[model samples]
Target: MWIFGWKGPSGFSASSTAEEVTQGIDGSALTAIVTGASSGIGVETTRVLALRGVHVVMAVRNADAGQNVKESILKEIPSAKIDVMDLDLSSMASVRKFASQYQSSNLPLNLLINNAGVMASPFMLSQDKIELQFATNHLGHFLLTDLLLETMKRTARESDIEGRIVNVSSEGHRIAYSEGIRFDKINDESGYYTWYAYGQSKLANILHAKELARRLKEEGVEITANSLHPGAIISTNLMRHHGLINTVGQMLGKYFLKNIPQGAATTCYVALNPQVKGVSGEYFLDSNIGNPSAKAKDADLAKKLWDFSCTLTNPK
Candidate 1:
């Protein structure tokens, strides 16, 4: 279970909590944009950063929920600098609007956490008619990153630090077929299974990190992108759209999986740890780099997915 360039704790299990992982990290001068920051793992991750003095932009689909999350954080840490921004990742149009506004503000974005995602939900179409999971979780983030690359570059240069984009993938990526991203059937119309489709979208997150890292390096930008699996946790509405079987599976997960804080551990670890400052395009868990499936490391597939995503989300 070894892979090249993996440099996290060895044999680390998935029970670490976000508060535990970020015990001593100082985040005073950092500004971050974290999607799905309104609840669950996202909310916990935001809290961890805010407690450390980092200004965070909670990018959520619903402005009301985003504001509520901000108030909750303010209540916990009265001096916490938190802002809410509207971003519906399922729509390319919304992603563009959000990125445009953020860039216009000229905030030095040290971290971008693509933490929002949906799972095992009934099949639904995005504004562009793509599958819901893939559209919101993968493609939206892809476009948003490209849109914000300039801001990230500026932040990296000004701070002399490696900028970061953390894609919150899942271990379920193991279910992706050997062929990798199935561009032809990306919409999954003919043979759609909720879990399988969710798996494919999660796999896209990993590949997006890998490919984006390579491209940013080639362009001489000091930015790092990586993916992680937040350990299974209850309390998130990610399963809100799930069917009975999926709901049952989520209940079973509570028995064996980490709690919400525990689930957010790897995400917080990757976002702020100096130990992993230069670690890009790697899969992580439990504050440690984990080995991805062989297919997950296929550069060709990653490139293909990137090109396909650009086309889907950035039509000329």
Candidate 2:
């Protein structure tokens, strides 16, 4: 029963825009990796960070789409330092390749935003024969983070600055997978429920952050791992495959929820804001450390997920 006391700092809000969240933050010395950067909140989040002179690596599956996103950012901020990298989160091989390339660069990563995801799509599997949502949303990021943990730790020690990893989760995680992470059923090729699987994956994101934080703490590392819900952003085409769901989500967005910039507030806040410089393993929403469900704080499940991820990634 981990109690989450929503002690919001000054200048934070549910409606805070990405620019507002990172106002006055100097990121010229930082390097960040943002997944799902091809479009939507992922793109907007990277744009905000890049505007601050942060060298942002746009990790996406499609090179052409990534180039388009890079152009859009360059158009907005001509001085934005944006690099496009091939990262198909659905494939373990692609994830490994990206990790290898990143590690070989020897550049310290200041931030990592696991923002790529699919929602409410038809059931599918990755090339690794894992559930699509679980593989891409949670497992892929899990492996990538594990692969780069050493680099982040080294960077923190060398620069004496906090290295951050932000797992972009959703409020939807609260609705499903409440019964605990089903490690046994994770690879049910036949039991394909988009919403349920998506929920489980999102929960895994939160769990991953919690577990990573615990491990880093034990290892005396300065890299912080935190999870955040980006709120309901209409700009992200997560529901494009589900026509009715997309329509309803859009309508709800028009009526309530944050705009694209606002939706990305908590994510940007967790990634670079000074208020949470050392805060890790916490679940945030609306730019504040909000209360997660009882299940979200299950340390045991977090450890279980971490172990499962280790087996999946086979990190030595």
Candidate 3:
């Protein structure tokens, strides 16, 4: 049944739902933070995690939308523990503030899903003057993870529960520019191609996860970091930037694209599945481990990207 690199175990497929993959898993003792949980795959990921009895925090840019999603989930699962926290991943100040607020709460961090991202859009800069897609999709999550590392490590050591970090990368990572990350020209619009820029950001997502997993292992921290391609999902607002092309493409590809819940399956699988415990520094697809591009597997490139990210996120 495996075709085009989209195959999983017998029980799971491209159409498998998040709930199906997470069945029999009791997450009552765990706490998780899911970024961009207001809609699309984020909402479904939050719902399934909360349904499994995990305390889920919906981190979103729009507070009102996040509250609405939280309320909707509460209506379905009366006992579901959910909280809506403001987090705008495009701004460095916002990332810092959100991390600070969460740290002040003294909550034990169990899962941090770097699921928020932007897709192909006209060239622009984030508030920090970095390219928008690179900043929001990679740098913000990079900084957030750095800020929360100690908390996750502490929680894992004290609770004796392995912590997990899932970065929602995309298969589009392969379509990045020839240079991969274009580190020297991130904000240069003259050389920018929207889709390639988005690809670079997604590529960075995988690289970030790879490097973090390596560091955690080197430090003997009982935490795991992994990344995955969530599939081409049509229902998500990620296509809002495409305008007319988005509508046309969705119309043509709706039947082939994964639904929101199905799109979120791989993420939930990597996040809560016992089968993948201790498995880190890998790329996943369709609820199973899969290979990424050769460039993506380059450890030297990952380390280089990590160092660049640190400088961008925490400059002296």
Give lDDT per model, in order.
0.85, 0.85, 0.91
The residue-by-residue lDDT of candidate 3 on 3-25, one tens digit each, is 24344653577777899889999
Clashing pairs in 1: none
Q: In candidate 1, what are the lDDT values of residues 152-213, reduced to their tens digit?
A: 99999999978899999998898865565678887767787777888888999999999999
Error of 2 at 38 (Å): 0.8
Error of 1 at 279 (Å): 0.9
Alpha-carbon TM-score of each model against the true structure: 0.93, 0.94, 0.96
Score residue 188 of candidate 2 by CA lDDT.
Answer: 74
Q: Is candidate 1 or candidate 3 better by lDDT?
A: 3
Per-candidate RMSD, Å: 3.5, 3.5, 1.7
lDDT of 1 at 124: 88
* Residue pairs in clash, model 2: none
- At residue 4, candidate 1 shows an lDDT of 32
Worst ten-residue run, lDDT, model 2?
Answer: 1-10
Model 2 C-alpha lDDT per residue in residues 1-316, reported as the tens digit of each score = 0013223564567667899889999999899999999988998899999988899999999999999989988998999999999999999899999999998888789899999999866777789888888899999999888888888888888988999999999887876654657788887756656777888889999999999999888888888999988876555688788888677778887656567888777888888889898899999988888788777899998888888888877845
